[model samples]
Target: MSSPASSPSAPPDTGTRHITATILLACLGVFVSYLPVVGVSVALPVMQQALDASTEGLQWITDAFILPTAALLLTCGMVGDLYGRKKTYLAGLALFCLGCLVCLTAGSVVQVCVGQALTGIGTAALLPSTLALIGHVIPDPRKRARAIALWTAALGLGLSLGPVVNGVIVAHTSWRWIFLPSLVLAVLTAVLGAVVLTDSRAERERHLDIPGQLLAVVAITGLVYGVIEGGSSGWSSAQVVIAFVAAALGAAGFVVVELRSACPMLDMRLFKSSAFSGAALVMAVTLFAQVGLVFALSEYFGLVHHASTLDIGIRLIAINGFTVVLGPLVGRLMNRATPGLLLVTGLVIGGIGALLMNAFQAGTSTGEAALVIGVLGIGIALAMAPITTIAMDAVPHRLGGTAAAANSALRQIGSALGPAVFGVILTHRTLATLPGHLASSGLSPADQGQVSGLVSNVGIQAGAFLHLKTPASTGQAQAAYGASFTDALHTCALVGGIGMLVAAVIAVALIGIRPARSPQTAPEATAHPASAAS
Candidate 1:
């Protein structure tokens, strides 16, 4: 279907006011969408208790949102380009608001999962459209870079504030109230978007590759499901094996379909550019490490330190606060410094922070944790915007939506994998060490068996351990559980640090020193003419 143009009553000329309005709306849209990504982490323990959710169930609560986001992003980006960016963007906001309402009223974990899925779908639409609109509105390369950096800053702010805001809510009220801010922001963004943003789409008649889209979604869903379930269900279980096999087939089918399609959703040739591939990879790995670190640390603060929700948020400020200050600064410096250099430097710094976290023990001080987390915050701020700039710059201006979507989808994929992988590592390590601890505790076999059953699931293990009220053995149990939890945290940090180091290496190897050309100088598509076709 062809997209309609901007309102006929609107002015013919694109004014500075329109540009500013568009940027603001786009930034708010991005910020709102990202709030739930990490904010929900702070509320997971509360949500688990309220919903009586298992470890896997809690994982699904987060995965349900991330899975669809990762899967549908590329397809939705294409949809926005083919239909209309503004229209898609507004629709996304409305859907996001609806999702928030669902979550706000949710009575069960299943309902929350459904709500999160809807939000993810909305985000899949919102993210690419916002970036695409920015590309459409700002034609100048230098100016566009700055605008994108601002957009990235908005995203960083959302990520940084999610935990803090949600923590405060959980502290003062209930976890359900966490959705209120997102709902309010989504509505505001939608209203502003409809009034300010000009409708724009690719002026070409490209067919949507439905088969490729379906296959992509199926592949990502199956893969993420397998990873998430692998921790609870044995990795060798039939369900897990079947999921992996199906994912493999779906991915292979998607490749075949895309290669043969006349109009592909994602052009495989984009990966041919080392710069593009590297930037995308760096984006993925950065989130993988960052998200995993956050997940581990949030639990550490709550379970290990016995901190309240608000206190946990306050402690976490060391990790994400710098993004608020450094995001725009990095954007401003993009023209002066190579993005590759920034990406590498940031990754190295972040990796060091992750490595530092490996020293954490049951008795580690809060100040030490804050110092390490502060280093991580600086690294994330320096790297996040530059990688995005590099990725979008590498693609054709006309394909901005697709490029943005692909980059975002990959990052979401990494985000989904991070928690699952870390959770698995933590659960397995904890479980393995628990038996040794129990044996040494001199507990009777029956009591040991009961204890094992109680802590069988990683989701409730820490809380259960902390709240142990047995008069005879409470102290010994606490010490054993503390040691085991600390060991798991150390292992997770090591893995995260190694991942960041790998990303740094990739950034150094593939990212270039040069800046991309402006849209005016970018090549126009002659193969795919800008003509109206059914």
Candidate 2:
């Protein structure tokens, strides 16, 4: 896989002072993007209670960001390529800062959702441009790799630290403080970006694919909405079905349009290279498994173990901490080994770690849980950077922007879909087993249903399960609730284990053997090939 077309003219490498300033600015932008995701997740329970939000509303709060990020990523990349990348990036930060401020003052869930959307858009803008700018600014391949390594490290740090940071802020003060720090970071990054970043754009005029963009947005939004709604309304509901259908149709239209357009938003031709296709497939599956695993496990620790948001964040940090260390190493490994090897090894390790995590019981020791999660983190660390590097390497220079955008979009979608799909599984499993688990414990049928219902909604963390507020006949209800909660977690663990095993197979078979050759080979196919492959 080769890089996209070279920039019309590369920016000259500046002295250390300028490089340091520019790199710092770019890192800051990434840090700001990290704020909303980790910050909001920590605040989810608070947001739900404070706003009197329904399950649907809670889902929306999360979907609001994922939808926009997935929808707008390609468009933002195109915009950066067309206009000045530096300009587009700074503008994104400004919008993000404004959105954070809006979140601070949001009186309702709807308002917060809107603010989150804006933050998503800003994130979309920042993502591709950072890499594009790095490619532009650092002409040397080795130097560029190093720069990218630093950039990725910042991202790893931001994602990992985001929850911990929010945990401290939310615990000490209000959730509003989570948004407050972002305001300052956004402003600082924007200003730094303006002063330090070099202006870069495609010298040639590239017409915007308006219809393709619109259809892509519709498809992504519908998909995100459908996934979010499916959890509460049931996947069988007409509302959920319509949303999924709309998303599918819109996505189909997008494909049709891209195939026909002279300059498509997504060049479908990139799949020609077996290497590119392999890497992309790995990316999608890896993300699906990784994102889903994190969501399920985090909720399990918090709900079943009765951990606070801060405690949950700290526990999760063990996994992400490995990410921080492994991210740069993966980048360095790209210099010597095939990305395919790294991808296969990483996924297998991660899958194994996930399987081990399935052994966690409700009464499992904290040390055991932490060990399982830490192993999973090691896998994440090993795989993520190499996967990204492979995808970027797969495309040519001009398409780099699009390829990067698509990569980010798919990951976001995976992130969004993970929770919803797994949440459904968890809910169903809890409902099915809770009654039986509690029935023989001598609780009243009515009490069994109510306690089961609570566990279903919040998993095992519901305060009612902890004896904080028991029914009038409390003894039986308490024991029954505890047993039911344990049953729910057991079910989730088994299902999650199965998912990891499947992902491991795909990684091994689909990704196949690691390339002995250089990554610069032509992608198996072009973005818009004239001849169709059978």
Candidate 3:
């Protein structure tokens, strides 16, 4: 296909109208791509009832989308560079819309998983293309940076709003209706992009690294599958063991292939720069903590606190919603503070928030939880943009697109791992403590048997506990289940808190201030010369 840059359809002038249209389309593209990820977290309880899905099934619903997106992101970016960004982006929107339709009509959890995987494939193409198109259309460096900041804000807005939108939908209508808005937005974005976006690609020929891509897919899938299944099946089960082993082999093969490939999906040399490596590590750990915490808290609010879907969304907004306001402010702070300093400060604050959440009790109020969540929101807002800037700055401009993809892929991998790991912890802890809680209750043998039967097969969702009919039994069951759920949430909070603390330490040690350079020196050494520290 001919590059969009070479097409005769280029706009006569890069006027205000053209730029606004391009930025809005890019924002919509990003917003729709991320909306479903956290939105589904709020809808998991409803899904469990509607589809009779297990906890593992719910994890698969999220991971099925995340795994493909993480694995294919770099490859898709390269495809956009070699082919045409506009073409790939349009194709992604179409595929995403198709996936939404399948999900809307899904009758079973397996069908939902299939649809999620398809949507993930579409996102893999959409994300990188959106960013690449911005760089292509906005030739001026200052304008390009501003446009990218707006794109970042849109991403944060989507993440923040997903739960709120899903909550409203679930409260009033079926959770299936959640996809309708996204579908509509996707169609609008596709139409606008076709009219406004200029076609563009890399100046040089690029080759797809199929073997490396396949290895990455297999490795992430195996590892996540092992984690998710190990919680249900015994950890030492044959299936879990085989999955872990296969993941190890796939990971090893991926490293070897990338090191040797002429056109690697991920250039291994990026890791040689401590700033790049530190930024990438921060991205992974932050998402790990953030995503896992959101999943665990969503369950806590719904099952333990008996909050409605809208209430749960409002509660979560305290944690995620601040990004919209704080992102651009932090972007401005990039001029005053080193990216390393900003990252360290943000991680520390986020860690403190997680630690505070660990103090939650069975009777904790929504107001109390929101207080800590707001703190986390601020921390995340401070860290996210700076880390992105640092990672992009660490690479040469020529590799800027690749660097962004790599950072995003690692972040998605962390996102996928978070739910799996936290879910395992939540499930195991709840199960281990349930018998004790039940034994202490003044229940007759019949009631005990009934409650045991109800809870033994399900996760910590309220649907299982809500089945108790008698008032006395229901009260006892709620108390027991709430206590167990609180304990599990605390454990998850501890894990997430410690992960962020580690990230903070890594940032301090590895992310250094930029060295001083002569004014006459060429800017190629640092990818973002404008933001480089003295």
Candidate 4:
């Protein structure tokens, strides 16, 4: 039996063309799939009014995309291994295009949700297949690391650029234009992928792990639904409780199924590597922290700050604008520092940024907020590329899809969970703070209730700004509301700070810093082809 690495492809020297082409092709999928999350947040009020959507229906529009993406990621990874990365990615692009068309024409909330779900599935396919293809096409460790860094940077670019594009489109045209750009981009990507991407499939023939896949889908959906809904349902509500229980059972079943399956959706044995485990945890937690910040930032800028939808998008973009510029620079730096060192340093910087925002008062100027956001962006750039490199490099060639899929899954889950969990914090804090303000000198109970309700409702709007109403009675409400928002910010910052500290500790203690060029430690380093050899 041939080693998986040696089965078909040329050695590392010959794979660069295929790798570059595939990465370019993969960028389209990343852009289309993730752009909606940010863009739609900016467009939610438009969507709500256009469709006359209920609050629950509006939430579903987002959840429809997230749940399916998280659930199907692992399965799609397996599919890439069983079939071929090129095949899977092409199919994904096709599916994504179809979903965008559906969204463009949707007259009802259900149709939008359906469209989102389809897009989510397509995204699942695109993500893992791209990573797995990288593993096949980039055979040299150094080149592969650089390639992975670029891949991650591309993903970050997609995420960062999504809202900016959406803002531009929505400002000039209708919300439907959001789908239009992606539709065109998707078709273009499909054509590019067809032309440039080579077919690369697994060497070992293995059946799909149906049981494991099913259980995983169940587990992830349950967990995501529970977390997302927990805020509205009240954590102690029967529905929330049931969702939690179902998630627990499903997750437990998935473990058992994977253990017994001949070809597992996830190989548990990989966790035996402390480096891999620590890296994975950092990816998940950092995403949790970062996404939470993004979520809150969207709300604060649009609703609380009373910025225009386009202004909100532009402002947020300005905050992270530096990151898009700095990411490649960091990628070059990774050639010098160990992944562990970069990861810890990035997390520390990002945590500080978050803490700064948490310390924010309603009195904070937009410039101050934007500066803090820029810091967070830099921190994300510093860590994300290196951490992804470490995790992907630790695993073997055959399981590349699985490892990538696992990483994507955790990241998505963290993103999903962050908003839901933090939204609750923001909500409670706002509500508690508003009542004292509502008790002002002249206001009746009925008017106070109305103002309080509106404040809460507005706070939930992403990319919208909020303002507190001064109570009729004295200047009571303004002071209290300020104090409350400040308290919430502090609490959020502290939580984020703790998470970063933990990540740093894990990084320093569990993840050893070896120089990136440690030829003595990694045999592959010495095996690189010299220019003469090439």
Candidate 5:
């Protein structure tokens, strides 16, 4: 917390060391922020076992981290613009590391969620700072594009590595141990950032938009809470209706607050540019499909296939591994290919990949599943860097921090909604179809009653693979559970697939208009130093 850094972008010189350090730390910062997303995803079944999490509770684990990250990203970007990027980076790392420590020893699911929220806050701070620092440190468009690609690749690498790391940790010891490596990485990055990073900020003055921020949080939180709870308690329930109403008011209020504010954290007029708005929507949709599929598939592999933690992680590699391998290349390709072209193409391919998952069954082979997953990953890799590139390019360099934060925030919002929305689909689908699946399994009358009661009380997660020991009598029950769950998985996959295709159509219509393409043409913000924390 120092005075406003209305100074120029930092590391004043483009020396090899400065550029190298900035890129490295930026990559690592994103790496640390995303490590938990899929890493914890692959461990969901194990976590369910260890913590006794019900279906909704499991979704909360992921959303707990994502909600805060989504809610605070814009505000945190303001912090970087007002304070220093390095300060925000360091602060973010410290909070993330502390959250890891809390998770490492957490005994209950709620405690783990509390820890995740802390990491989410840290993630919110880290994301915009890292990207903005890169923008500042690398002034050349080509070099910045490459750096952003590499930054995105690092995110892919983190996601790719999470399952492997978590798998090994869970294989050897407790699921809690999964947080240890991330904790270590956060500490190392913070220390290095403290030494190597230089301070930078928005060239223009910025202030906190506390009212807007609060409304954003309320809108996002209420929306997610309603969707998730609506699935369990009837969608028509009083609680769900109230939550939806609150969310609508909150969203409308945020827009009003931003419109009237002297110093808005995010200028409402920015969306007037099609590229900026399209990228935001696409970012949310892409993550919504990708993350939601992972949540559903993780359960499928673990529960239906009876895969071990290591097995589950290994199975998921193709989904993120392709992204890790292709990210830098995609960056290069952007120089030649139009971002809109690449973006639309990726969405189509990813949509196809998601639709293919409808073929996945309890007995599907690993090789069979790998093909679809690989396609999905490749599609995602192609789209990921472009979203960042288009969003950054659409805005002036001075607004890089705002653009990055907005992009990252939308991403997390989609991520939070993914589990909430997908989990609801899976829950309702499984429950609706479970009776037929169970009856077909030829379960004894007594067993049927008991199993139905268990699902009723504890949710569908009561039938985890670990709980379905394979005795002659129990074999029928396991098969029934598998059939029901896979049916749900297919439904989830279809939802994701259709979502991707729709996003593709959206990309075609937008991501091209750039009315305020240049800094000189763009409208300027009002000057107001008045501030408040979100």
Candidate 6:
């Protein structure tokens, strides 16, 4: 990405001070981008009441952000390369700050959804651009690995603290105020990046691929939409069926479009390298288990155990906090050992931790929950940094932005899929089994039917019964709910655990230890005859 004038034959390494300043802005950009993700879920109830939102309205509040981020990723990476990296970085920050402002002042749910879309766009633009910036500034592969690890840690920090921060905001002030801190940080980072950061892009020529962009949008949007709706409205619903069809067609169409286009947005050949493909798949499935389980566990603690938002956030800190704590150590390990070995080891440990979560119940002690979740967090921390390093290192350095975009898009898709997959499992399992639990509670048939109807009608929101204390009947209802929910939790854990183990096996087969070779080991040799996207 360096200009001929700026890049020397043996370019001296970037200054420590300069790299520090660059990472500060990059990390800040990443931090604020993720703050709203888990944070908003904590505030959904207040949002629902304030806006009088319907069930559909509540779902869109989260999807509004995810759809745009998933759809725009590759396009945003190309934009950074075609326009200027610094410009996209600044634009992304400005866009996020604007979205926060809009949401903070929103009076209706529609406005909030719109604002969320804007923020999602900003995230799409920011992710690859920031990672590409790291690639450009740091010439040494070893140094870049460390930088990317810190970047990953920043992302973890944002996610870990989001709920805690939002919980405090909701407890003390309005839920609307949750975006205030993010807005301030976005503006600050934008100013800092504008002042000190040097702009760069792909040294080789590239162009915007309109057809590819459009197809990517169609494919990703359809898939995410179908999954989200399929869970809520039932998989057999007409709209859900149409959405899946559109998604399949769009995905096929996208591959054809990219292959035929003169200027492809993403070079499909990158996946030919075992390293890149393996890392990308690992990222998707890992997040699938991680984020998906978070959604289920949050509901478990909130509804079944009657934990407040703050308490739930506190409990989750054991998982996310360990990720941040282990970041630096993981980076050093990757530098010293075979990254693929670490990757497989982490996934295996994570799989074990996920399987152990089946033991959790409404009465499970916080200490017991923490011990299991902490193991999973450690595995995530160990594996996350190495995946980025392996993927980034597998391709030519020039393709860093595009590679980051592709990997990130998969991660987002996994995240979006996580909630949908687990939510469906939890909802269907809970509803299907609730009646049986009620019937066994020694209640008369009429009373059993009445309580069962109330819980069944609410679907998974039967967690809404967490606080009901009306009478003996209510106590019976709560006990039945706890049993049903624990069953569902066990089911979710079994599915997630199996998926994690399967992904680990795939990682072992596809990725190998990096061999010692020439300094020009990757990029130059990795490129094919039609490597140029333009």
- Backbone clashes for every candidate come to 0, 16, 2, 15, 0, 1
Error of 4 at 454 (Å): 4.9
Candidate 5 residue runs with Cα over 4 Å from true position: 1-11, 465-470, 512-534
| lDDT per residue as tens, model 2, 1-534 | 112222445444566776776677777787678756755765666666678665457667776776787788888887887776787799889878878888898989999989988888898899888777765655444455556667767777776887788788878887776788788888877877776777777544566889999999888778867876777677899998999999999999999998888877776776665555656666666666665665666656555665766777787776566767876677777667766677667677777777786577666778888898787778777777766666665565546666677777777777677656665665566566667767887767777677766666654445333442455546666555545545555555555555555655665665555653343434334343312311
C-alpha lDDT of candidate 6 relative to the true structure: 0.79
Task: Give the TM-scores of the predictions, in the order they appear.
Answer: 0.93, 0.88, 0.93, 0.88, 0.94, 0.93
Considering lDDT, where higher is better, how would the candidates rank from best to worst?
5, 3, 1, 6, 4, 2
lDDT of 3: 0.80
**lDDT, candidate 6, 1-534, per-residue tens:** 555423323232378887788787788888889888877765665676678664456567877887788788888998887777778999999899889999999999999999999999999999988898788777567778888889988988888898898888878888899899889889888988889877776766678988888888878778777877787788899999998998898889889988887667878877777778888998999988888788778778777777766777777765667668888988787777878888888888888888999989868998999899888888788788888888887777777888888888888877777766777787778878888888887666777776667656655564455333347767877788888888898898988888888888988888865552334455545554324432
* TM-score of candidate 4 against the unseen true structure: 0.88
Cα lDDT tens digits, model 1, 1-534, are 332454322222357887888888889989999988778876777787788887677778888888888888988888887778888898888888888999999999999999999999999999998898887777566677889889988887888888888888888898999999999988877877777677887755566889998999879888888988898889999999999998999999998887777788887777877788899998888898888778777777766677766677777775667877887788777777777787888899999889888788877888888888998889888888888877787766666777788889888988888887777887788777877877788766776666666787445444345434476666666666777778889899899888999999888788755554434554333122211111
Model 1: lDDT of residue 52: 81
lDDT, candidate 5, 173-269, per-residue tens: 9999999999999998999998888888776667789999999999999999999999889899999999999999999999999988887877776
Worst lDDT run of 10 residues, candidate 2, spans 525-534
Using TM-score as the measure, the top candidate is: 5
Q: Which stretches of candidate 3 lie over 4 Å from their true place?
A: 1-20, 137-145, 444-446, 462-469, 513-523, 527-534
For each candidate in the order shown, give its overall lDDT on alpha carbons.
0.80, 0.69, 0.80, 0.70, 0.85, 0.79
**lDDT value, candidate 4, whole model:** 0.70
Clashing pairs in 3: 4-199, 5-199
Candidate 2 residues lying further than 4 Å off, grouped into runs, are 1-20, 139-142, 453-512, 515-534
lDDT of 2 at 149: 63
Model 5 backbone overlap count: 0
Better TM-score candidate (5, 6): 5
> Which of 3 and 4 is the better model by TM-score?
3
Q: Which candidate is the best by lDDT?
A: 5
